[model samples]
Target: MVNAHQTFVIVGGGLAGAKAAQALRAEGFTGRVILIGDEPAPPYERPALSKKFLLGKEERESLFVHEPAWYARHEVELHLGQSVTELDRAARTLTLSDGTRVHYDKLLLATGAEPHRLDIPGTGLAGVYHLRRLTHAELLRGVLATLGRENGRLLIAGAGWIGLEVAAAAREYGAEVTVVEAAPSPLHQVLGPELGEVFTDLHREHGVLFHFGARLTEITGQDGMVLAALTDDGDEHPAHAVLSAIGAAPRTALAQSAGLAVLPTQRGGGIRTDAALRTSDPGIWACGDVAAAEHPLYGTHLRVEHWANALHSGPAAARSMLGREVVYDRVPYFFSDQYDLGMEYSGHAPPGSYDQVICRGDVARRTFVAFWLKEGRVLAGMNVNVWDVVEDIQRLIRTGRPVDTAALADPGTDLASLAAPAD
Candidate 1:
């Protein structure tokens, strides 16, 4: 029922690539499948790296997306520790770091993203760390354990989810934590000031020091080890180690090198793809963090770096590659856990996009659902310590219908019913 001469190649080794490979086999693609990764380890989930694994509560073996034997058993040609250096779009071939040339009838780029490295001085110090890869997490885990035992100080350079999550884990280890951020509040760009204050208060209650409205100007060290960090405010915080948690940039160099269209950095830069996840080149497809696909729901190109995006988009792209009608329009979603607080945010409401924020529960008690509305319609929703309502929230947003302000803000009202027209 298929062309035996066809071969599909996936160019990333993260969650997206692994899921794409799995979907290819499940979709009855009998042709050869090759999965290439620069990292030596098999694909693994990244959320735990900043949460339980960093806190030593989760085992490294549990992070993998699939057992090592699954690849062999599924006949997925796994190429570990190899980087795809050149993409010859004309010939449909990829040149690897080891000088190996592989041909493919179709290609999927799930290159994922890389953590932004601090350009400040002292980043090369022995105690400085980043948390994008498994190896980095493994090394940081040991450093945190030692710092916890010694009652050492840890200074973080950002207050995004990764920075705050790492700060929480450090507190669990009894390490002194200080976070320096340029924004007035944590997650200012994403959550706006109102909700960002919630995160700031949560971390502060956990004994974490926050130097808001400041940026890390320099990291001072001695004998190749971190000693202190200097902020733009001329204050120096003593630190035994430093973690740069600024954020991540999508890896689009490969796609760009092959003349694929990419979005500008300001637009959440990634390889630009259509609604079907097909890139400028029809023979090539992209998904996960690297693919900035046009979203029919949002009416724009979006590239989300959350685990959910990678989890769903890979299979979507795989099906699209198999010539099935596909539209990659999943609502953006991500969750974070810090100290005693856990939150799941669905939809996008970056600052200036929404007109008002309304809450349905007790914000002081940290059990609430906050909605971002534009012109009285639900644009996004976030539930803090609240569960079983994501579907309702998403439905409300999808309906694009205005609801009664009082009913939208009432916890007693059924969210499902609110999606309908008012009586």
Candidate 2:
């Protein structure tokens, strides 16, 4: 029995869940489908939340992946503001927080992650904040409005994309933002030293403070609101508010409660899944930040918390659940635009994983492209103010092409002609 009319239930109605429902219908699956989410709004893009959205450049509606009317036309039921409290994998039933049960032949778990909290004191104070959703940005905006042109202070904990982006956004608000990172440089774990130095200089030039190799000791407060935070270096910095952008963990309690085999998170804790994006229980499928899928590019299973990866991962899992043989093989890419400067990277080139770091143009002027080469193959590249070379590098990374870094740095070289032979 093919179960063509069987119900397909997708949990966590973010970009992943929304797209899965759309792709399933587009692929001509005449099955009963429902999308569940804890939020009251339609699934929307999140990358813009910390950058363009927070900067007040884009309206909320423009961030949505698809319009609500499209879903209506397709007849996909969206359960907004509804939380799935329990999942009975054997029975394929999902229990909502309001005591309603949803049954499905195939279950997709796109439940994303939550902001990592600071264990320091004064964490519950009012002035402190973390940016994850559009609501979070609006709340921060409200706080900034009251402190307009005052000696405002924002202490951002963690040096990840969210933290750095928030730092840039906070500075734009004229908030004296100080970023505290335990690591020596921003994006050290992801981009390594040379490229991270570029980010450090860029942010400092934008009037943002950086506290590298520092740890949070305690967050001081008064009147139940935040005031300042003391660091392990025996220094106290006054702050109007504190934000813990430390990172996030996969929201996997429901899956764990339902007896699903969640994967081990080496970088941080997150739910694990097989190559097909299936949990230990075959009836259940997971994707996005929640399910840790084996990364063919990274050579280990990882939970990619990026908008592009989440979008592709969601539909890939959905298609697999529909008994289609499509595998989600994404290039694992993410971008950050801070202060009119654009930075993009693809794939995680291992530490010293490459034999060469070639630069075209000037690094001091911040107008150059850096390439990562392993043996004779181009693994990755970082470009700033150099779109031409970045595009050429992107193509090679995707195709696993070999190239001569020395020739790439030559100003007169036509990179397209020098690209490695296609395998």
Candidate 3:
């Protein structure tokens, strides 16, 4: 419980949870912080797990959140391998899997999500995999190890970032990879079709097979081994291993059990949260992939499952929990490096969100910067090779200032000159 000193119990020890704990300490919140995580080890980085680690390039220990001394130096009670089975909001306590009750005056729920598994007929068969945690990557790493010199066949179940990243890694490990997505284009709704085309070509160049607008129906096994996954598209193929990367649903069971109201989002997944990252119950907060935040810029509730969003939202929620009012309306940004392309995008430009599309370079040459323009204002910016455009566009979007959209489209115009001087 919280005496004059605040005792905070944070559930889930992924990027969000670790960032929350770090934020509390960074803000001089040195009362008593207990990070309750279900994983056996302390919090570690997750992004590189799919990239460098999966390719067998990164060492395992390099992923640790920080040196062991960092947690000790911050005075945070690091509870590793502990499962918080139930929440006792009435008593302001949590019952661990071991039956010990831990008390807290304030609680931060950063319970990151698990991958959405396919309901296909053979999904439960051996060699079917899910990628969301370090353990999941380790399993795939082991599978790739068993491949020897023979090219492995990998069928990735979704076209999201996780699926595509895993595909890149599989290709690096001498595997033939196929990406299947029900959506018409990869990250289409978020990045819009213009940029999605850029990615379509990129994957094609890498010799990655794409089955767009096709839904998987069954993952059938042969002799207890995962051999083929039939699709709604009437195609059946063999894959040595299948990775279900359909993304994650919000981990809201804890909030729901704690008697807090959980609202479903418009985007077909995740929990709804206010501007301050609080659920219906003020004492509890949610962030990371789980929280659907009301974005002031776009005038919509944006649920971003990106590394930058987690880094931003975690600290934003911690500041709110510490009684500081913070608005998290930054221009959303995410980047992925695949097959010699340093792809990056910031802000969102759904269809009709922008009236005009501005181009700064040639897409035919496979290098350019593009801007989404709405009423002479920069709505979003994407870069395939020229990334400096994002920095200027990010500033222009945050202020909602009028820009010279015509000049910016010419490829020679300097974007920074379009913004109004700061008052």
Pairs in steric clash, model 3: none
The digit string of per-residue lDDT tens for model 1 on 263-354 reads 99999999999999999999999999999999999999998999999999999999999999998878899999888888999998899999
Give per-residue lDDT, candidate 3, residue 225.
88
Sum up the clashes in candidate 3.
0
lDDT of 3: 0.80
- State how far residue 257 of model 2 sits from its true place (Å): 2.2
lDDT of 3 by residue, 223-330 (tens): 998888888979987788899988778787877777776656456445667888887777888888778778888887777777888888888889999999888887
Off by over 4 Å in 3: 1-4, 420-423
lDDT of 2 by residue, 1-423 (tens): 124468999998789899888888878888788999898889998998888888788888988888878777887888989999888877778899889998998889899998878887778888878877768877876666455478688888998898888888878878788899998999877776767888889889988888999989898888888889999999888898888888888898888888777765565556677777877777888888887887666567777788877878888888888888865657667788888787777665756677777878788888877777887677777777767555566677766656766787885787776664554
Candidate 1 regions with alpha-carbon error over 4 angstroms: 1-4, 421-423
Which candidate, 1 or 2, has the higher TM-score?
A: 1
The 10 consecutive residues of candidate 3 with the worst lDDT sum are 262-271
Show the lowest summed lDDT stretch of 10 residues, model 1. Answer: 1-10
CA lDDT, candidate 1, residue 227: 94
- lDDT against the true structure, per candidate, is 0.93, 0.81, 0.80
